[model samples]
Target: MVAIPQRTKGIEVTRADDATTTEDFRRQRIAEAAQRARAEAEARRAAADAGNPPRPREINGRDGPEPVRYGDWEVGGLATDF
Candidate 1:
């Protein structure tokens, strides 16, 4: 009986650090955006509480200016039929 030791040649094992970095970057970017949105909303609410409100800019998707709504306001604006 003869014993032979064999090794695999030219088989490359790679660590995909690039993929990990890309996914991590995307996650961090999304988290940053969410945090910024939350901060902005909090600031706006505080301003409203102080009797100073903000208005939307004309650059938005709407064709014209929209009233800044606060505290249980309806999206359909003021309702009629009183």
Candidate 2:
């Protein structure tokens, strides 16, 4: 009969200092999202000032805004919520 090992090798234990709590992670994510939004807004404003309007973002696998469908109703093309 073959003998089995009691403990596995290379098992890593995370240190308390290296671990992030759920609350901390949530706050970090929120901050990142807000930063991205602000940056996009600033870019749009800059483009407008330069007389070059920002192109519509790709939606529904198309180059420009397409009609968004909600249940039986066809909503407006600009689907920003996605």
Candidate 3:
């Protein structure tokens, strides 16, 4: 049987190694892209939720900061009621 040349064998091995490295790099890029997309989606969802400011509710002609009920009542802010 005829034997392959040493140079050809070396080239083949090098090509196989390069292919594996290229595949690994491609996979890593895909994973990074997917992670970035997920982060962007979450950020967009958060931004959408934050887009519209909440309309303040008024009770007894009081503004947003003032709790409607002064007795153990609370709103978005800390409880000023005692």
RMSD of 1: 14.2
Q: How should the candidates be ordered by TM-score, best one leading? A: 3, 1, 2
lDDT of 1 by residue, 12-31 (tens): 32334444655676788889
Model 2 worst lDDT run, 10 consecutive residues: 4-13
Q: For candidate 3, lDDT tens digit of each residue in 8-42? A: 32233244446676667678888999999999999
Clash count (model 2, backbone only): 0
Taking all chains together, each candidate's TM-score versus the true structure is: 0.42, 0.39, 0.43
Clashes of each: 0, 0, 0
Note the residue pairs that clash in candidate 3.
none
Q: Which run of 10 residues does model 1 get worst, by summed lDDT?
A: 5-14
Candidate 2: which stretches are off by over 4 Å? 1-20, 52-82
Candidate 1 regions exceeding 4 Å error are 1-16, 52-82
Model 3 stretches astray by more than 4 angstroms: 1-14, 52-82
Query: What's the C-alpha lDDT at position 15 in model 2?
Result: 45
> lDDT of each model, Cα atoms only?
0.56, 0.57, 0.63
